[model samples]
Target: MKIALCVKQVPDTSDIKWTENNTMQREGVESIINPYDIYAIEAALKFKKNYNAEVTVFTMGPLQAVDMLKNIIALGIDRGVVISDRKFAGADTYATGITLSAAIKKELPDFDIILCGQFAIDGDTGQTGPCIANLLNIPQLTFIKDISEYNENSITASRFLDDGIELVKVKCPALLCMLKSDFEPSRALINGIIKAQNSDIKILTFEDLGLNPEDVGLKGSPTYVSKAFRPDIKHSGEKHYCLENNSGAQIIYDKMKEIGVFNG
Candidate 1:
């Protein structure tokens, strides 16, 4: 089976900063694989182990993104493809989906399964994966919590919903947007790391993918950030003390009543 996993290099959330243009300040900040993408990688690895599948990971970012690709390759992926070009900068979910769909069509024409995270940490829009599926005109299952069965022909997965889980069976050549669940990510093996270090990464630019300059990046994005600001949050703390007796219980009850937390 040929499986393709889409991943992203996202700014570390712990120390995220915004630029004057209302964009993420990536300079000098740490970058890591989108946490949700790790679960997608894990799912692909599971498929490889169970069915002897070949997995390839794809990302759209700058040259620095090669580092993120190498890390995923170290997790036993067979190859890495980086879609890097200045024209791809400031791409929104729609533009990103178009760019990725073009690349996938060119690179993995016969791919059996495509997997991606339910959403990227930086955007949290959860739109790209489904958008890609729509652009590619393929069946897609989003918010997948578990993949129960798979073969060369089809896949059966457990999808998470607001109320309950739904089991879905889809034909091959489908896309799955995965969510982290009980499965733990595996560490890179020594051999896998060495292999990743030595392997050549494939880089694709906008022109190479036959994309028009106007069809990518900010120009292609229908939405734009009008304003950005952090809301002021206020915090208050209170402490109360009473003797270790019925008075303490009474005091607690009184406080709860005062706060409208208790009526009895």
Candidate 2:
């Protein structure tokens, strides 16, 4: 099976930088792989181990992202493809998805499955994966907690929903957006690290992918951030301290209920 993994190099959330226009400043900021992509990597490695599947990772960023690709490549993936170009800068989720879809069409046309994180930390819109599926015209299952099995004709997965878990069997050539779950990420193997050093990272430019500047980056983006600011830290007006097994807690709850707090 051919598994295509879409990953991203995001600025370390703790030390993020923003531009005057509200877009993230990724050029010089210290960056790391999106934390949620760890789940996607873990899932891809599982497929690789169980089914002997060939795994390839795809990402879009500046030219420096080559280093990020190599870093993940050391995690036992086969190869990496980076979509890098100045024209791709400031791309919103929609344009980003378009670019990635085009890259996948040109690079991994025969891929049987595509895996992505539920959302990227930087964007947090959770729109790119579904957008890619829409553009590619493939079935997509989001909020996926686990992938039990992948057979020739279909793949079994469980979606993590708020109310309950939903299990479904999907046909091949589909996309799965992985949700955060309790699992350790796979470590870098020695042989994998060696392979990464020797592997040649493939680069696809906007023109190389036959994408127009007007259709990508800030230009192609249909939406823009009008304003950006941190919300004020507002705390609740009342504070009550209750000792263990104290009736005061119940009294406070009942009084709040009397006041129709949350209609409880």
TM-score of each: 0.89, 0.86
What does candidate 2's lDDT look like per residue over 49-95, in tens digits?
89998988999998888988888889988899999998999999999
Candidate 1 C-alpha lDDT tens digits along 1-264:
898899999888988787776577768889889989999999999999999999889999999889888888888999999999999999999999989999999899889999999988888999999999999999999999899998658999999999999999999899999997776688999999999999889999987899888888899888888887766576685656555454777777888999899687
Q: Which candidate leads the pack in TM-score?
A: 1
lDDT of each: 0.90, 0.89
Which regions of candidate 1 are displaced past 4 Å? 17-28, 235-259
Model 1: lowest-lDDT 10 consecutive positions: 237-246
> Where is model 2 more than 4 Å wrong at Cα?
17-29, 235-264
